[model samples]
Target chain A: MTEALASAATEDILREAAAWRDAGRGVALATVVTTWGSSPRPVGSQLAVDQGGRMIGSVSGGCIEGAVVKEAQDVIADGRPRLLDFGVTNEQAWEVGLACGGKVQVYVERVE
Target chain B: MKRDLLDSLMQAQRRGTTCAMLRDLKTGGQGLYINGEFTGDFASGPNLKPLVLKAISEDVSGRLPEPYQDIFVQVFNPPVRLIVVGAVHIAQALAPMAAMAGYGVTVIDPRRAFATDQRFPGVTLLNEWPDDGLEALKPDRRTAVVTLTHDPKLDDAALSVALKSQCFYIGCLGSRKTHQARLNRLTRMGFGEADLARIHGPVGLPIGALTPAEIAVSTLAQITQVRRAKPAAPQSAAA
Candidate 1:
């Protein structure tokens, strides 16, 4: 299931990337490298964060979207990529609304 | 990607197969992209378009696995389907317009003369009674059934079946008075008030659509909106 969802997610990112490239708009890709605790989606989930921080997919439910968006925009601005993680416990998860306790590690990268 | 699966999907689509395409949206390689009837790798360069076109057009055979298959299906899958139960002029215009809007259109009418290929050129023409046809068609969550016949016999069967099943959208062509009368009939037949409410009588988005073509467009637009609108956020955003 992870592989299938990732595959489609990747396709969507690539397709969007192509569209952005064709339109001459900068884009970046973010992947969920790892996850912990109760989460809606699993690891390998991705969110294609564009230069404008407009997302094309999701990495975690809404738990880490804001953080991911910030990271994506930073990646686009820096023209470099970085990996980030979030929600290791109730305190950190409180901001993202993860039930019980859960966490996610995301890898944000810019692709040509 | 599995060649056989792609073939099955395309073949089903060409033959108007009624099934949902479940796309996996979280995986792919280097630069693979998928649009309806097209799947190509960014690394492959210019050759990708031709490859995808050829693959969709020809009787290709393969089984798609995990992410790639899901993406292929999502990009190519027919989301909401419009099954028009009448062969009116409105259907003629609506069928093509709906197709253009990415809907898998099926026009069903017992009148062979009315529901001809000429009338709905590119549509999946089914010359059968609405009820019988719908029974065989089996309306699912992704299916939307519309009754333009305005005739009780034809429209009622569809409404009955649609009300019983999980069909997402069910609309009938009628005026306020006609709709009330239809609702009364449905009530008499033991349809609950809640069930009767599902019918979108006076179909179409109150866009002041007058002509048959205009009405068709209005109906299609409303269906599209209903299909794409995201579900409201519940208490939890876990998944």
Candidate 2:
């Protein structure tokens, strides 16, 4: 694990906003639209990652955040909104930090 | 629309006030309405605002205790506060933690040298005596006061205000012996034993902490426990 403990998910979201502002890029907000079983983050949990590789917010238990961040940067670059879904099967869920067979669907859109 | 209302609610929370956010959860995507204003993308009828406001006022005043009251009202505007009656190392640690936990932290100490914005950045530092500062604070159910001075004059003065007010958590940093002494003195000063019981002495949880930072973490854990017990509402405020 990294030496730094994970920050409050809220901080992650705002940092993304600042990054967008700093880099003169539009922002895309991603939110957890659905969830099932024991999940660290609840529905409506949001992460707004910008094109400048800076992020603020979290959607998974530190599992899907990196993936979400990547998609967010792409959304910023393309200026097209998309709904990215993850955590369907058991194996898929395990890859994204969802243990205990919990699946969460995240909706990512570029809403500047 | 949801974002706008949430931002307004968070603004009120940052100022240590309560606000109501109404969300129509029946639909697939919720519509957030704040203070009777149709702030969402989809507009409902005009009368919805009055109805939601009535519901919110009643819920905040405790006239309604329905199961979803927490979701409907409290989470929309969570209480964020910091009551520090002393300027010490423990207060140094506690102030920042409280801020990190989304509290609008305020520090009170008569010693101007001890309490300064430089010592505790991003916190409101009051260079007034505890009693004077607390009187201005008007601690309510959302406020959390912690005393680290171990000086009776400062602790007692603030405790009097905190116990009478609606503050939920009252903690004084002291050992077992000091706590007993505090209780005895407060009892003599006309405070009931029950009131004394409300104050958490030895301050934090029994985490065997020694340093100021560690102790701050333990105190934060205890404070979070109280916060979780009273899940305010589900509205997010912008920092």
Q: Candidates' TM-scores?
A: 0.52, 0.73
Which residue runs does candidate 1 get wrong by more than 4 Å?
A1-112, B1-79, B231-239
lDDT of 1 at A65: 83
- In the range B55-163, model 2's lDDT, one tens digit per residue, is 4443331111343322222123343577888888888998878777667678899988888778887778888788888989889776789888889998899998888
lDDT of 1 by residue, A1-112 (tens): 1222313234455466556755766677676655566666654455766677667878777767887787777777776657565765535555664554666666666655
- Candidate 1's TM-score: 0.52
Going through the candidates in order, what is the number of backbone clashes in each? 23, 12
For residue A45, give model 2's deviation from the true position in Å.
3.3
Give the per-residue lDDT of model 2 (tens digit) for A4-41. 11123343454546445556776777766556666566
Worst lDDT run of 10 residues, candidate 1 chain A, spans A1-10
CAPRI grade, predicted model 2: incorrect
